[model samples]
Target: MGGRLGGVGTGLALGGGLSYLAPQYGMACDSFKELEVVLPNGTITTASATSNPDLFFGLRGGGGNAFGIVTRYTVQSHPIGKFYAGTLVYVLDHSQAVLDAARDFIAYNTNPKASIMATYEVLTTPDVLLNLDKFIVVFLVYDGTEPGTAFRNFTQIPHLLDTSKPNKTYTEVAEMPIPYTAELSRADNVFRIGAHRIEGAAGLQRPRELYDRYAAWAAANKGLYVYVALNLYPVARSMTDASRARGGNAMQMPDGPWLWVRYILSTPPGLLPGVYDKVQASFRAMVEATPSAPGLPLFLNEAAADQRPLSTFPTYSRLQQIKRKYDPDGFFVNRTGGWTFD
Candidate 1:
């Protein structure tokens, strides 16, 4: 949705992805040296730490569309080297253990080089519910061959599959079979996505509850859709430390480790007429049922339409000022697709 290398530009703007590497090298925006932007009037300008500093600050971690067209991004580059990468799969039978391990891993592990994205999903078909097909797919990566003590909890989990790759190039890892895609056509009908925050000592309970609710919701509405998946991505605050080090950005994160929970549901086009309202309602219910840490922000790239990613930013007022300064006439505001401060 944000442009590939898989949302590399938007990730820089929203303080998303690269959480595992963030504490070390800072976020994608920390290295953002320059951007060539075409404003509403077709005026072209360059922004960076040195020139047009206000727009530079505004562009970093401020959701796209609200600003202007970024013709080119001049970013600081890092050396490409071999790294460890792998995928691990486990059946739903190990859900309890896997969930527990994920909680513990984020709560205790302090390694800056290691990162893991754990997704618990139940694939669906027309006749079958796909529980037997449920899987907790985990992506593990480290700057080195070994993920070290930080990832032992995940490695030790009983699993049905493990395809760990060592010394793989960044491009190879990017090309790996990650489920994220660029498709926009709803050949499968509308997909309702939802995002929520999960954190703290209740991290274990909140996630379990959300998973159970989504499971029940899908089961009750199973025949209407093809699949529903719950994705859990870790949001470590160490990433924020890095963001702030680079003069900060718009995404003001809460303290400690948190989980960016997203629910994805698919329904065949026009299969169930007028069902979208009910479906969206159920999605909202699931989000409302989840417990979120105070001030936790949404990752704009994955957020649902109704979810207020802009309001979640602690720097809301500052962002509004920047928006006014750049586009006082609200040309971008009326024409863009993001949640604006206005």
Candidate 2:
């Protein structure tokens, strides 16, 4: 039942399946290739990069829920092997230093073989802080082998408290328990509210002052607010760039090198509304404090509701044209609203 597909093939099938059926299958935005969609009036249609190329590109990352009902997909496959991956945890007191180090490490990261994800957390109980209050940086080195060389390079960081063994499956690595999964789910009715913020006008390139203010806010609101996880992924340039060369586009995001930062704000259900408002205000203030730049495009699935319109569709006019040509009736619409074909 298992097979490997190239990024494009993988994306189409995966993205289509998840959007239509199991979201738990995760998103296939990065692996889309072709789609079989059911149009209004029960008409069935097929699209690929070669035939009906416009619809193919539009569905790639134009978002699934807003692109008709995809029933089948033909994706490209590839040979994938074992990879080296693990997480490193640190204390809350060192949040700033750890974040600074992680940012520096990623900004200059040149290892084509290694990928890293760095995250931060704020805990309610001092005990949770004592147990898991630190920054957890997950490192994955894809060399198709175990105990790869990248682990050695990462171990050089003096502050790391612990590290996991190298050889692991991509599924194993991706499914690793992120911070506060249980608490996050329990605090809100919709996972949408509990999801991370990694895109939009709120890019990770926050100014030093904003970073400092956020840290101070976390410290002051300790027990009431719990968990802020910032994730930074170092995907191989070849993986993203190749998609573009093949007529696939989502990866053509902003120019500057960027890190994906996710802030997970949670409070007990009873205290949720007030805390949510405060956190939103803080986040908004943080974005307003920074200068605007076309740094990174928002990952639509993970984006906050009020992000800039163009962040999701960098080429709006073009995307709209594709939408019009394929979805003439505009039957496909986003659950959160705002997207229009005309």
| Whole-model Cα lDDT of every candidate shown, in order | 0.66, 0.49
Q: What is the lDDT of candidate 2?
A: 0.49
Number of backbone-clashing residue pairs for each candidate, in the order shown: 1, 13
RMSD of each: 3.2, 6.4
Tens-digit lDDT track for model 2 on 116-194? 5565555555554355554555443344555445445446555555546556666665555556653545764111111
| Candidate 1: regions farther than 4 A off | 1-20, 126-130, 179-200
Tens-digit lDDT track of model 1 for 261-322: 76666655665556867776776776667644557667666666566677777877888888
Per-residue error for 71 in candidate 2, Å, reads 1.9
Residue 262 in candidate 2, Cα distance off native in Å? 2.6
Instruction: Please name the candidate that would achieve the greatest lDDT relative to the true structure.
Output: 1
Q: Which stretches of candidate 2 lie over 4 Å from their true place?
A: 1-30, 126-134, 146-153, 159-161, 183-185, 189-210, 254-256, 272-275, 308-312, 334-342
